[model samples]
Target: MVDAYLSLGSNIGERETQLQLAIEQLNMTPGIRVKRVSLIYETKPVGYVDQPDFLNLCVSIETNLPPFQLLQACLEIETRLHRVRKERWGPRTIDIDILLYGKSIIEDEHLSIPHPRMSERAFVMIPLNDIASDVIEPRSNKLIRTLVQPDDSVVKYK
Candidate 1:
């Protein structure tokens, strides 16, 4: 099984419930095991600030699925949670991103591993640091702890 990290966020109705449900669903998926989860955090929206603040957390899992398959699984979870991708960075019921997939470097038209923007987002980094601070960026080969953004928006919500 490949170790993977995922970022979960919600900015719309019942945000906390959405996040918790997503975690439960991910755990129920075959070939996927949810191992560790960071405390939920509240952060201002990154790209689009006009929307509501987001509740975010990071989860570590072990999965046997390939990258695309993993992406598909995330998409499925979003769909089930009533996510509507009407606009880029728009408010949603839930958003799940594959932050890292073991040590593999993947670049494809549909998805990219090591999540291209993870290092720059405090929401992603703060929670990630909770579970895997030693994880190395596949492209830069730097430990995640060194790449943590100095933004003050991310804070433990619980």
Candidate 2:
């Protein structure tokens, strides 16, 4: 199985519950096993500053499925959670982003592994550091712990 990391966030409805529900659905999917999860953090919205603060967390999983299939599975979970894509970075019930997939670097129309903007978002990096601080991001060949986290407000909520 390939080790993968997922970033889950929500700002509408029950935010923390949305993340938990997404994790549950990911675990329920075939060829995937939820391994470790970071502390849920409350973070201010990034792109769309006018939305509610988001509850974000990182998830480590072992999956036998390939990248695209894994992306599909994540998309399915988001859909089940009533996510709407009316605007980019807009408020949503749930958002699941593929942060890392094994040691591979992937750049495709549908997705990008080692999520292109992970390093820029403390909401993703801080939680990533919690579970896999020493893990190297293939793109940079540097330890994830060494990557700088944005100076944004992130509070442990759970």
Q: Flag regions of model 1 displaced more than 4 Å.
A: none
- In model 2, the runs with Cα more than 4 Å from the true position are 150-152
**TM-score for candidate 1, residues paired by index:** 0.97
Query: All candidates' TM-scores?
Result: 0.97, 0.97
> All candidates' lDDT scores?
0.93, 0.92
lDDT value, residue 97 of candidate 1: 98
**Candidate 1 residue pairs that clash:** none
Question: Candidate 1's residue-wise lDDT over 75-135, tens digit each?
Answer: 9999999999999999999999999999998998899988999888899999999899998
Displacement of residue 13 (Cα, Å) in model 2 is 0.4
Tens digit per residue, CA lDDT, model 2, 17-123 = 89889999999999999999999999999888999999999999999999999999999999999999999999999999999999999998889888999998899
Task: In model 1, state the lDDT of residue 132.
Answer: 90
